[model samples]
Target: MLKKLVLIGGGHSHALVLRLFGNKPLSGVRLALITPDIYTPYSGMLPGHIAGFYSYSQCDIDLQSLSNFAHAQLCLDHVIGLDLKNRKVLCANQPTVDFDILSINISSTPTKLSVPGAVEYTIAAKPVAQFLEHWYQLQENAVRNPQKALNIAIVGGGDVELALSILAGVRKLEIYLFQSSKELMPSHHQSVRRIMRDILSNQDVKLHLGERVCEVVKLINKGLTIKCESGLMVTCDQVFWVTHASAGSWLKAAGIGTDDQGFILVNDNLQSVTHPHIFAAGDIAKMINYQLPKAGVFAVHKGNPLYENLRSMILGESLKPYKPQTAYFSLIVTGDGRVLANRAILPLPSHQLWWCWKDCIDRNFMAQSPHQ
Candidate 1:
């Protein structure tokens, strides 16, 4: 009997797996990919795309062609739940998909809050697809009404500096960033954080640190009002939520073994601790022994190991363990052809040379697709 292998999301890891499988096929193994978007945008270049440095087509991974090359059915639907006991996959549009092996690479989302108009007014900026859609529409609105006072609010800390710097180029609008903590990018080097803070202030980007938004009220014919728990109110044209990262809500309800944050718990082999038949990678998974920060580079590197382990598991062979590196270089686009990078305690100041290096890396990584 042929074995069924279903990949839940077209994330970086799964995309790499598809490319590898396209080159080498495991006998009697049927593969399929389930994702909501036909083109999964690469996070490495997403900030550039939003900043207007890169075009939409440049940063997006062509999932359709990749699936075709891998000889996998690309199911254009959202995975709503899983029938774990029956070893079946549940989706929003398609019928139940039964699989011998399942690998989930779905990325995490911001923990949805129950603010006044948050559900209706705020946009969660993870999972990439929805944020892209939301930005496009908002950009159009801003372009059409040049005379309208435009105020954009982003609620999140750390690395969001990259986003705010680039988003300043998106339009001639007042951009505000709010972090609940007193300090931004707390994990980063103090010098690097100070440099970013200076850059934002110099760019006229309003900074509201230590103010956590508790509610959002959509003003009729005006804009949206954001109320912070710190007794502050600000109205903006759009509110983007990039709060704490949390995985799919359905994972817990479906009885999947996940961490406190709702990410699937997997062993070093990337197999679920409780259910060996299920595997997870990327931001959607957490390693039981050593946890990896939610980074695209880690996901990119996990591709080969995940493919090897999957092949090993299906063939009744010993599964090789995948040990993620303790540290990796970080390339952050500053939205103006300059980049800031750091690896471990070493930090590189903002410079165009770093930007060139980052652009080269991103382009090279994106250029590998057989068809993109």
Candidate 2:
């Protein structure tokens, strides 16, 4: 019988895996893809998409056509639970899927903070599809009430800097950004963070540094407010939540070895430490041996090795390990057509030229994707 290979999630890594599988066939193996979304949004261009630089379709990679090329079954359903013993994947809207080898590339969840009234008050800036839908509606409302003062609060660090710029620039709204740390983008170079901090300050963004949000509550008057541990309280028309990035709770609940944040624990080979037959990639996974940031670039890097290892496992061959590079070139696209390129040691100016380069890189990535 042909070995069953089931891929979960249509994330950046899995897109490349499917493309590679489509480019080359593995005999005696049947492939299947289970994802809730038919189109996977490329995180690289997501900022551009939000800034009105790229259309939605331009940034979203079509999985349907790619699956067809790979001769893989595309089950458009959300994987709610996993059955490790039976080697089955439970879906929300479809029948159970059986697999011999399973690879998960599901992107991480936006946040796990269970702040009171968050569900009713705040909008998640992740699970991209939902964010798009909510943002579009909010944008429309903002347009309709152009005279109304639009006050918004974003709960996150420098990761939300791009979104903050867009919200301030595009809508000309009063934006408040709250971070738990004294400095933003602590993982990044000081110059990069300094530049962004300066930009936000000059652009009239209210930066609440070192203030951690404790509780979110809807006011009786008309708006929502969040109280910080530092005793700062602000009422806003909308609260955009981008603070944390955790993994699917199902992985940890199913007894898979995971980090404290619920990201699947895997070796350098991308194979689960506890279950060798299962592999994980993208933001949903944590390399036990290395500290890899949850970046889309890493997900893009893991694709080739993940594909090769999956193929090798079926043939009973030795699996190759993937050691991620410590630092990567990061280009932050400021909403107003400026790009900040971080090369660790280089103190480069944020320029439109960099924006051109970033656009070319992003457009090229989308152009090379599997499409019919």
TM-score of 1: 0.96
lDDT of 1 by residue, 120-164 (tens): 888988868887788889778878987776788888866664456
lDDT of 2 at 49: 79
Which stretches of model 1 miss by more than 4 angstroms? none
Worst 10 residues of 2 by lDDT: 160-169
On a 0 to 100 scale, what is the lDDT of residue 149 in model 1? 64
TM-score for each of the candidates: 0.96, 0.96
- Estimate every model's Cα lDDT from 0 to 1: 0.85, 0.85
lDDT of 2 by residue, 1-372 (tens): 799999999998899999999898989999999998888789988887777878888999999998998899999998999999999999998889999999999977667367777767788777888878877787788789888878888888756545554564357588888889998877787887888888777778888989889888888887888899888999987888887788877889888899899999999899999999999999899898998778889999999999999999999999999978876688877777778888866757778998898889889888877678
Q: After superposition, how far is residue 102 of candidate 2 from its true place, in Å?
A: 0.2
